[model samples]
Target: MKLSRILKEVKINSIYRTGAKTIKKGGFRKNSNYDPDISSLHYRAQDVQPGGLFVAIPGLFADGHDFIDQARMRGALAIVSQKPVQSDHSVTENISQTKAKQIKNDLTVIEVDNSRKTLAMISAAFFQNPSEKLNIIGITGTNGKTTTAYLIESILSAAGLKTGVIGTINYRYLGKVFENPVTTPESLDLQKILDTMQKEGVTHVVLEVSSHAIDLFRVENCFIDTGVFTNLTQDHLDYHGDMDSYWFCKKRLFTEYLPSGRKKDRAVAVINRENAKGRELFEILPVRGISTGNSADNMIRPKKIEHGLNGIAGNVLTPSGSFDFKSPLVGKHNIENILSAIGAGIALDLSLDHIKAGIENLFYIPGRLERIAGNNGCFVYVDYAHTPDALSNVLGSLKAISQKKIICVFGCGGDRDK
Candidate 1:
């Protein structure tokens, strides 16, 4: 792809020619003669290859601008930075004058107002905007995002649409799975994965969007068709500082990103009406809202629910129709997850039969109330509930179903909110 094409939508402050001389004063011009063929896009200096574009991000721990010289040494043709690349003498201070001049002469540095947002736009452009080619369902919140994403994926798969998933456990499509280091990947990796999924004929994708990813502009260019808000709780306060700041980050998925999606005209928000923050988000959403909960006023709710050690069986009432569903997933919290998935199914115009089959087919999600055989007729279950609210919900569910005394064991990690 040409540099001009990759930066077509990027907001530029200035474009610097070889030797750090100013070429264009503002933005990019389609008819400009400085368009170079870009082979790839990378943020890490070590990953830069010949003819690649490197984006310098000012991260929390380390600033990528410090490695501009390394990127140039690795044969990067272009550099994108929020700060003035020429004004930073630290990048060339250690090198000999001849080598420093060569480095500058071989580079085309473009200054942008925000490198994070620019990286997203250029990545989407470089990959031909794969999100637009697929129906992306973004699930955001604190506790139930992973399970809700799995349910949505199962439902979409039951509808006979080839699907992919990017979530807490892993990223998988067509029998290929990649380890997930974060709930949401960086923009470059995300676009590349979506592009691969699109080429493999995936029609829909279910993504678990994290607050950190949203705030960092990782999902800024994703065209979400359905945005699902499961529920928010007291978690990640170490990073977000307060509940309000965390809520604002999660709300951006629907308010800021969803409205600019490819299916913006049909974009829908599947909200957990039982949650106070979710209810507030539903009221302020710019697109259509599909409320899900046990409340009578919810658009998607459970008509009758039965919970036991074996699993949960219930009839879910939705705008499309009522469907009897059974799942090996236990707990009242999973009821909210089921309703959210059903609402997502309806938003995508899926048949109730498909939704029912999808719900019943998924037997388990790892570490989410996973049952284990125990000695002396004891039942042991493992769950990944770390927050106070999540732990309370798990214990509450167990209390409701178990007649015998229940023993609970848990621990907290370091560097997290107490």
Candidate 2:
């Protein structure tokens, strides 16, 4: 696609303006009509392609205005700055904090109120909106987004669909894996991953949409076919400051911006009914929703729940009827994850039988109730349950089968949940 088309689609209304010193330095594009061969939807100097549009997003820690010089030096043909316009200001003065605030008026920067949201819009435009071409499922919550995302990916893959996944563990597509530190990568990386999946013929994608991602508007323009709320708990309080704010952040995936060109009713919401916040999220859904829980009212309800040494067994009651499934995914929390996956399968038009088959076929998911072997008859399971809700579930699940004392050795992070 052409540079103008990318900018036009993303509503970026500005042209390339080489800085005076940059023009004097000679590597910059002098002409306003000069278009770049490649463009980026983010501000990362490293990720900037030659002739890319660097999105200079100002954050609490540092102003993107500080990095504009570096980006310009690295062949950034244009920049989309998120600075406010001030009436009484001048661009001729040296670039200072005071001066940058003032120059927002006459600069040819594509100014946006929210840079994070703009990045999502630009990424979607650059990637030709790849999320629309695939069945994208977003799993969000304080906990279980990673587990549930991986679980859904496993179930989908077992059903013979070429699926890709993006979560806390990694970004994966057709056996190719890349480590991901952020639970959700920035919008441009996500778009590139989806674009790769699209090229690799991946039909479905299961992505873990974190609250940070939601608050940052990282997925503002992505089309999510189904949004699943696993379970919310006290987490990311350091970032959001309060439970209300955290919940509001997670709610973005289900409530605020969703992809365009799809039927309004097509964006189905799948929620965990056992969780109070998840149940509350269901009420906010404009479209009819499918809920999963261990209780009666849930569309995907678990019955005859039993835990064993190896795994857990349960009969899930779907819209069609009840069916039995046994998975290596232990703990009641994992049962909830199973239900979330079942809800996703049903949303995708798969029958109860196919869903059951898919569930049973998944025997492994790293770090979610993962069993470690030892010489004795003792059972040791490892999990990614740093949050209070997840900790209680893991310990409580083990306590059900524990004849002796159930000792829980744990430690909380210093900076988080403070």
Candidate 3:
């Protein structure tokens, strides 16, 4: 695509063309495009190139603005910054007059209100707006995001849609699966993944939206078709500063990003009414909220639940209809995960039977209530529960099923104030 197209799509404030600084062929000196065409989108200065777009995003430890000189030296043709550049930003600024002039001639700096948001918009545009081509479902909460994401993926696939998933476990679509260090990837990687998914015939994507990702603007413009709120609890307080701030961050998914699209109905929200914050979010959701919980009047609820070590069996009731919900995954806490996924299915307008098929087919999810053999018929299970509420739910569910005394062993991660 042309440089004008990328800038036009984002409507950036300014674009200044600089002189060409040539590089050795097949080496670092190989000059990138002298003009507006961009070969890539990057946030870090180290990754910038002559034709690459470098977004100066402010971070907690280091600020990209401080590394403008490196980006310029690395041949960054287009720079996205929140403010105008200063001559002292680059070490090249103090270089010999000839080198400094050539550096100046080779740079094009664009300023914007928010460089992070700009990176998202430009990344999506650079990837040819791939999110718009797929049905994206975003799940947010302190817990249950990964489980609900798995459930939704299975449901979409059962409906004959090729589904890709972006969650805590990994970002997977089509036949490829790769480890993801973060719950939600930054805009450039996210847009690139969605672009690949679209090309591979993936019709749906499920994303786990973490509070950190939301607050940092990582999920800025990858418009969500459906947003599901599993529940919120005491978590990430240090980073968020308070419970209110934490809830506010999670609320952004329903209130802002979820509603941006041509079809208002497609931008549906699935929330857990049992959660105080979830209920609060439901009221503010841009679309008609699909509230799921034990409440009789909720849009989606479980009429009857039967839990055992084998699995959970329940009659799931939704606005579309009611069906028998069965899953091999254990724990009563997972009931909330199931309900949230059911709401997602309802939002997708999937038939109740398809939802049932999807839920029952998922036999297990790794490191989540995974059962292992123990001596003398004793049972052992592994889980990834860190928060107080999450641990309580897991232990409580296990106690309910086992008549024998239950012993608990857990520890918080290093440096977690909670």
Candidate number with greatest TM-score: 1
Full ranking by lDDT? 1, 3, 2
lDDT of 3 by residue, 61-145 (tens): 9888777767777877767888766443452244456656556535666767888888888887788789878888988999889
lDDT of 2 by residue, 137-169 (tens): 888887777777877777787778999999998
Query: For model 2, what is the error of residue 39's alpha carbon versus the real structure, in angstroms, after optimal superposition?
Result: 4.3
> What TM-score goes with each of the models?
0.95, 0.88, 0.90
Q: What lDDT would each prediction earn against the true structure?
A: 0.88, 0.74, 0.80
User: In candidate 3, how many Å is residue 210 off?
Assistant: 1.0
- Sort all candidates by TM-score, best to worst: 1, 3, 2
Clashing pairs in 3: 18-105, 19-105, 19-106, 23-29, 23-30, 24-29, 24-30, 49-75, 50-75, 69-90
Q: Comparing 2 and 3 by TM-score, which wins?
A: 3
Measured by lDDT, the strongest candidate is: 1
After superposing candidate 3 on the true structure, give the runs of residues whose Cα lies further than 4 Å from its correct spot. Answer: 9-11, 17-35, 88-105, 263-265, 416-418
lDDT of 1 by residue, 1-418 (tens): 9898899877777776645334435545666646778999999999999989999998989989889888888888888988776533334356567756656435677888899989998999999999999999999999999998888899988889899999999999988998989999999999999999999999899999999999999997888999999998998888889988999998999898888766789899999988999999999989999999888999998977999888999798888878798899999899899889899999999999999999999988888998888999887999999998999999999999999999999986757663
